[model samples]
Target: MFENATKQLRETVEAALPELNTVVGWRAGYDPLHMTPVFIKNAGDLSKLEWSPFCVQNLSGYLVKDPAVRAQDPSKKIGICVKGCDSRSLVALIQEKFIERNQIHVFGIPCRGTVDWRRVMKLGPLTGIQSARVEESRLVVEDANGGHTFALEDVLARKCLRCAHPNPVIHDVLIGEPVTPRVAVENSYGEVERMEEQSLEDRLGFWKKELDKCLRCYACRNACPLCVCQDRCIAETREPRWLTQRVGTSEKFLFHFIHALHLAGRCTECGECERACPMEIPVTLIKEKLNKITLELMSYEAGMDPEAVPPLLTFNPGETGL
Candidate 1:
C-alpha cells in the first residue's frame, strides 16, 4: 500500500512542480530504519522522496526554520507534504499567519501509523535492516541475516495509538485515499486519563523523575513544529535570563514548564518532541495534560478550525473554571 502511495505521491508532486518553487519531503536517511527531510527543486530529486512508516518527522516546521525556504520571493509558492497530525501543525501555523494559505501547497497523506525504532529493538537483536514493508497484519523486515516479521502493535508509536486525526484536515492535493482515524474524537484522552487519577504527589514525582533524565539538549523544543521562537526563546535569552546555563532537575522542570505553557492551545501533538529526545522521555504527556485542560475548560481542540482563534489566544469573559 505504501509503495503504491509513494509512486503516486512522486507523480503528483511532479505534476504540481510547475505551481511550486520548492517541495519539502522525506528521503531515506543514513540507516534503513530512518527517514530524513529533504528539499526538492527539480524532478531529478524526486527519487530522494519516499513514503513509509519510518517517515516520522513533521516537516511543517521547516517553512519557518529554513532560511532559504522563507527567503523565497513572495510570488513563488512552496509545497509541503503532511501526515494527519502534521496537517494540524500546518493548520496552526496558518491560523497564526506564520504562513499564508496562498503561499504554499499542501500534499496530505492519510497515515496509518508510524513505527517507533525503540519498539522495534525490543522485538529482538534486530539490526542491519536492508528494507522494511508493512503487510496486512505484520511488518516485514529484511536484513543482512534474513526476513523477519512482527506484529504492528509491538512497533507502533504511542501517539498513533491515540491519534484522533489520521486523515489530513487540510490539503491542496491529497496523495492517497483518505483513511479511517485510529482514534475516536471522543476517546482521545485515554493516555492521560489514567495519569489524572493519580495523587498530586505521584503526578509530581512522575515528572520529576522524567525531567531528571533530561540532558538539557533542547531536542524536544527544537523538534516541535509550533515552537517558532528560534533565537528569542526564553530558554537561552540573556537580557531576560529566563534560564541559566545550569543543568539540573529544577532547570529541567522549569524548562519543560515553559515549553508546555508556550504551546498551550497550539501544539498539534505530532509526537516529534518525544521522538527527538535522546533520553526517551515521555515529554508529550506534558502537552497531553495541557490539551486536556484546554478541552475541559474551554471546549477547544487545537488545529481543528484554521479560521477559529485558539482559545487561549482570545479572551472570553464568560468562560468559567478559571
Candidate 2:
C-alpha cells in the first residue's frame, strides 16, 4: 500500500516544486528504522522524501514554530505532509488563525500508527538496524542478528492504541486511501478513565513518580507544534516566573501544569510530547485530562472542527452550566 503511494508522493512534490519554495517531509535518519523531518528546496532532493510507519513527527509545528515558514512570502505556498494526528493539529492551527489555510499545501496520508522505538528495542537492541517493514498486523524487522516479526499491537505507540482519527482531517491532496481506525473512538479514553478510577492519592502518587524522573529537557515543549511562545516561554522568564530553573518535584509538577493548562482546549493529542520525552513519560496524559474536561463541560474537541471556536477562547454568557 505504502509502496505505490510513496511513488505518487515523489511525483507530486516534483510537479509542485516550481510553485513552492520549500516542501517539508520526512527522510531516513542514521538508521533505516528511524526517520527525521527535512525541508526540501531543490527538485533533485524531492526523491529523498519518504513515507513509512517510522514517519512520526507532526510536521504541523513547522508551519507556526519555524520562522522560515512564517516569514516566507505569502505569494508562494509551502507544502507539508500530515498523517492522521498531524492533520488535526493543522486544523487546530487554522482554527486559532495561526496560519491561514491558503498558506500551505497539505499532503495527507492515512496512518495505521507509528512504532515506539523503545518498544522495538525491548525486542532487541537499536544497533545495526538493517530494515523494517509493516505487514498488516505485524512488523518485520531485520537487524545484525536476523529477521524477527513482532505483532503490531505490541510495539505501536500508546496514543495510537486509542486513535480516534486515522485519516487527515484537512488536506489539499491525499497520498493514500483513507484508512479505518484500528480502535474505535468510543473506548478511546479508556486510559484516562482507568486513571480516574484510581484513588485520588494514587493518582497524585502516579504523577509524582513519573514527573520525578523528568530531566527538565523541555523535549516535550520543543516537539510541540503549538508551543509558539517557546522563544519567550514563561517557564524560563524571571519577571513573572511561572516556573523556575530549580529542579524539584513541585517545580516539575508546576511545569507540567503550566504546559497542560496552556494547551487545555488546544491540544490535539498528537502525542508529540510523549514521543519526544527521553524519560519515556506519558506526557500526553496531562493534556488528555484537560481535553476531557473541555469535552465534558463545553462539548468541545480540539482540532476536530476548524470552524468551531474553542470553549475557553470565547466567552458565552448563554453558557448553561458554567
Candidate 3:
C-alpha cells in the first residue's frame, strides 16, 4: 500500500513541480525508523518521499510559514500531503482566510492508523530495536534478536481507533483507494463524558493529579499544527502575567484552561497534543469536550469545508440550540 502510495505521490509531485515551488511530505529521519516533514524544492527530490504509520505529524502548519515562496512568487502554488485530520486543518485555515485554496496542491492519503512511539516503548524496555515495519496490519519489530509481530490495532494510538474520517475531507488528488468508514462509535468522547459526570471538586482533583506530572515542556502546544500564534503566547508574557512560568498546580491549570479556550472552535481533534506530551496527558479529552459544546450549542464542526465559517467567528442572536 505504501509503495503504491509513494509512487503515485512522486508522480503527482513530478507532474506538478513546474507550477509549484515546494512539495511537502514525509521523509525518513536520521533514524530510519522515524519520519520527518520533508520539503522538496525540485522534482528529483520527490524520490525521497515515504509514508507509513510513523508519518503522523500534521504538515498543515507549514503552509502558513511559506512566506519566502509566497513573497517571491505569490502565484506559485505549494504541494502538500495530508491525512484526514490534517485535511480539516487545511479547510479551517482556508475558512479563516489564513491561506488561499488555489495556493495549495493537496495529495490526500487514507490513513488506517498511526503508531504511538511511547506505547511501543512500553511493550518492553529498549531492546535495541533497530527498525520497525508494518505488514498486513501488524507491526514487525526488528532488533539484534530478530523480528516479532504485534497486531497493529493493539499498539495503534487510541485516537486512531476512534477516528471517523480516515480519508481526507478535502483533496485535489487521492493516492490510494479509500476504505470503508468504520462504524461510527460514541467512544471517542467517552472518557470526557465520564469526567463530566464527576462532581466539580472530583473533576478538578482529577485534572490536578494529571497536571502535577507536567514538567511545563509545552510539547503539546509545540506539536499542535493549529497553534500558529507563537509570538504572543500567553504563557511567555509578563506585563499582564496571564500565566506564571513557575511550574505549579495554579500555573498548570491556567495553561490548560487557556489552551483549551484558544482551541474552542478551531481544534481539529488531531490528537497530536496528547501524542506529543511526554507525561501522556489526555489533552484530547479537553478538546473533545469543547468539540461537543461546539456541536451542541452552535451546530458546527471545524474543518469540514473551506467556505464554512466557524460559529464563534460570527454572532447570531437567535442561536440558542444548547
Candidate 4:
C-alpha cells in the first residue's frame, strides 16, 4: 500500500509540477521511524516524496506559518500533500481566509493512522534502524540487532486511534483508497469524556501535574495550524503582559490554557501540538475539551466545511437550540 501510494503520489506530482510553485510532502527524517516535511520544486526531487505511517507531520501549517510560503508568487499554486487530519487543517485555513482554495493543489491521501515514535521507543529502544515498515497491523523494525515487531495499535498516535475522518475532507487529487474511520464523529471524544468523569478537583490536580512538566517552549503553539497570531502572540508580547517568563505551574497553566482558549472554535484537532511537544505532554487534550464543548453547544465541527462560518465567530441573537 505504501509503495503504490508513493508511486502514484510521485507520478501525480510530476504531472502537476509545471503548474505549481512548489510541492510540500514528506521524506524520511534522521531515522527510519521518523518523517519530516519536504518541499519539491522539480521532478528531480519527486523521488524524495514518501507516504507511510511514519509520515506524521501536518504540512498544512507551512502555508500560513512559513514566511517563504506566505510570500510566494500568488499566481502559481502551491501543491500540498495532506492526510485525513491534515486536510481538515487545510479546510480550516481556507475558512479563516489564511489561504484561498485556488492557491493550493491538494494531494489528499487517506490515512490508516500514523505511528507514534515515542510510543514505539517506549516499548523497546532501537538505534541505527535499517528499515521500518507496517505489515498486517504490526510494525516491523529492522536494525543491527535484527527485526522487532509491535502491534500497530500499541504504537499508533492516540489521536489516530480515535480518528473520525480517515479520508480527506477536501482534495484535488486522491492518493489512495479511502479508509473507514476508526470511530464515529459522535463518539470521537472518548478521551475527553473519560477526563470529564473525574471530579473538578481531580481534573485541576491532573492539569497542574501535567502543566508542571511544560518547558515553556511554545512548540505546541508554533505547531498549531490555527494559531495565526504569529508575532503579536500574547505569550511574546509584554505590552499586554498576558504571560510572564516565570517558570512555575501557574505560568505554564496560564500559557497552555490561553493557547487552548484561543483555538476554542478553530482547532482542527490534527494533534500537531501534542506530536511536536518534546516534553511529551498531552497538550492537545485541553483543546480537545474546548472542541467538544463547541460541538455540543453549536452543533458545529471545525474544519469540516470551509464555507460555513464558525459559530463563535459570528453572532445570531435569535439562534436557539443551545
Candidate 5:
C-alpha cells in the first residue's frame, strides 16, 4: 500500500528539489525493523527514501534542533516529509518562530501508525531480521530461521495506537489518501485520564518509581524539537547550579518535573522523548498530563494551528478561573 505513496513522495521531492536546499525523509536503518532520517539533496538519493511503519523519527526536529539544517542558505527553502504527529511539531516550531512557515516545503504523508521496534523485538524475541512489512493489519517478519507474524496492534508504537490526527494539519502537498484516526479528538487523553484515577499518594509513588530509573542522560530533552535551550539547560548548567550529580529519586523527580513544566502548553505529543529514553521511561506522559490540563482549562491544543498562539505563552486581560 505504501509503495505507491513512496513513489509519489519521491517524484514530488525530485520535482521540488530545484527550489529546495534539502528534503528530509526516511531511509532503511541498520536493520529491517528500523528506519533513520535521510537528507535528500539530489535526485540520485531519492531511491534511498522510504515510507513505512518503521519510519518512526519525527523529522520536524531537524528544522530547529539540527546545526546542519541551521547552516543552510536561508534563501533556499528546506523540504520535509511529515506524518500527522510530526507535522504538529513543525506547527509548534512555527508558532514559536523557531522557523518561518515559508521556510519549508512540506510533503505531508498521512500515517496509519508507526511500529514500536522495542515492542516488535519483545514479542519476536525472534532475531536476525532480514525483512519486515505490514499487510492486512499484521506485521510479517522474515528472519534467518523463518517467518513470524504479529498483529499490528501488538507492535504499533503507543503514540500511534492513540493517534487522533492521522492526516497532516498543514501541507504544501499531500502524498497519500488520508486515514481515519484510531481515536477521536475528545478521547485523545485516555491514558492521562486513566492515570488521573489513581490517588494522590499513588500518583506520587508511581512517578517516584519510574523516575528512579532515570539516567539523567537528557535524551528526552534533546529529542524534543521545542527544547531549543540546549546551551543553557538547567539540568547541566553550573552557573545557577540547579541539578547535582547525586543519583537520588528526589533529584530525578525534580529534573523530570522541570522538564515537563518547561513544555506545559507547547508539547505536540510526538512521543520522541519516550522513544529516545534508554530506560524505556514513558517520558512523554509527563507532557501529556500538561497537555490535557491546557486543553481543559484553555480549550487549546498545541501545534494544531500554526497561526494560533499557545495559551500559556500569551495573556488575556479578561481571562478568569485560574
Candidate 6:
C-alpha cells in the first residue's frame, strides 16, 4: 500500500514539476534508519521520496519561509505531502495568513499510525532489527536474528490512538483509499482531567516533579510547527528576562507555562512537543487543558479549517453581554 502510494505521489510530482518550484517530501535519511524532510527541485530527485510510519515530522513548517516561491506566480508552485495532522498545520497556517491556499499543491496520505522509535528502542537493544513492515494486523519486524511479528496496535503511538482525523481534511491529491475512521476516544485529555481534580497544592507539586526533569533542551519548541516565533521567544530575550537562562526548577516551570500559554488556543494536539521532549514530560497535558478550555469557552478547534479564525484573534461585541 505504501509503495503504491509513494508511486502515485511521485507521478503527481512528475506531472506538476513543470509549474512547481519544488516538491517537499520525506527522503531516506543518511542514517538509513530514519527519514528527513527533503525539498526536491528536480524530477529525478523524486526517486528518493518514500513514505512510512517513520515519516512523522510535520513539513508544513517550511512553507512559511520559502522565499523563492510566489503565491501569484502562474508558472510556479510548491508541492507538499502531508499526513492527517500535518495537513491541519497547513490549514492553521492558511487561517493565520501565513500562506495562501493556491500557492502550494498538497499530497495527502491517510495515516494509520506511526511508531514511536523511542518506545521501540526501549523494548531492547534492537540487536537484530534490520527493518519494519506493517501487515494488515501486525508489524513484521526484521532483524539480524530473524523476523518477529508484533501487533501493530501494541506499538502504535499513544497520540494516534485518540486521533480523530486519520484522513486528510484537505488535499489536492489523496494517495490511498481512506481507512475506517477510528472511533473518537476521550483518552487524549485524560491526564489533564486527572490533574484538574487534584488540590491546587497537589497539582503544583505534580508539575514540579515533572518540570524538574527538564534540561531546558528546547526540543519541544523546536519540534512544534506552530511555535514560529523564534525571534521573540521568551526563553532567549534578555531585556525583560521572562525566564532566566539558569536550569533551575523555577525557570523550567516558567518556560513550560509560557510555552503552553502561547499555544493555548492554537495547539492542535499533534503530540510533537511531548514526543520531542528529552525528559519525557507529558507536555500534552498542558496543551490538552488549554484545548478543553478553548473548546468549552470559545467553541473552537484549532486547525480544522482555513476560514475559521482563531478564538484569540477575534472579539465579540456582545461577549461580555454589553
lDDT of 2 by residue, 1-322 (tens): 5667778988888888788868899998878678999998888897789998889899999989889777876799999999989999999899999988888898888899998878988977646879888888898888888888889999999999899899999888888789898765556788899999999999999999999999888999989988878778777888887776778899999888888899999999999999999999999998998888887777788998889898888888899755
Q: List residue ranges in candidate 3 displaced over 4 A.
A: 66-72, 183-187
Candidate 6 structure quality by residue, lDDT tens digits, 105-147 = 8988999987776666666356656777676767667777777
Model 3, residue 172: what's the lDDT?
90
Model 2, stretches more than 4 Å misplaced? none
lDDT of 1 by residue, 1-322 (tens): 6889889999999999877889999999987778999999999999888988889999999998889999986787999999999999999999999999889899999988999988887885666888888876588888878998989888888899899898889999898888888777568888799998999999999999999999988899999989999878888888978777777789899999999999998988999999999999999989998998888888788998889899888888887877
What is the total number of backbone clashes in candidate 6?
2
State residue 313's C-alpha deviation in candidate 2, in Å.
0.6
For candidate 4, write residues 232-259 as lDDT tens digits.
8888898878887888899899889889
lDDT of 3 by residue, 267-321 (tens): 9888888988989988888888998788767877888878888888887788788
On lDDT, the leading prediction is 4
- TM-scores for candidates 1 onward, in order: 0.97, 0.97, 0.94, 0.98, 0.98, 0.91
Candidate 5: the clashing residue pairs are none
TM-score of 6: 0.91
- Report lDDT per candidate: 0.89, 0.88, 0.82, 0.92, 0.91, 0.79
Clashes of 1: 0
- Best-to-worst order by lDDT is 4, 5, 1, 2, 3, 6
- TM-score ranking, high to low: 4, 5, 1, 2, 3, 6
| CA-only RMSD, every prediction | 1.2, 1.3, 1.8, 0.9, 1.0, 2.6
Model 1 — TM-score against the truth? Answer: 0.97
Candidate 2 or 1, higher lDDT:
1
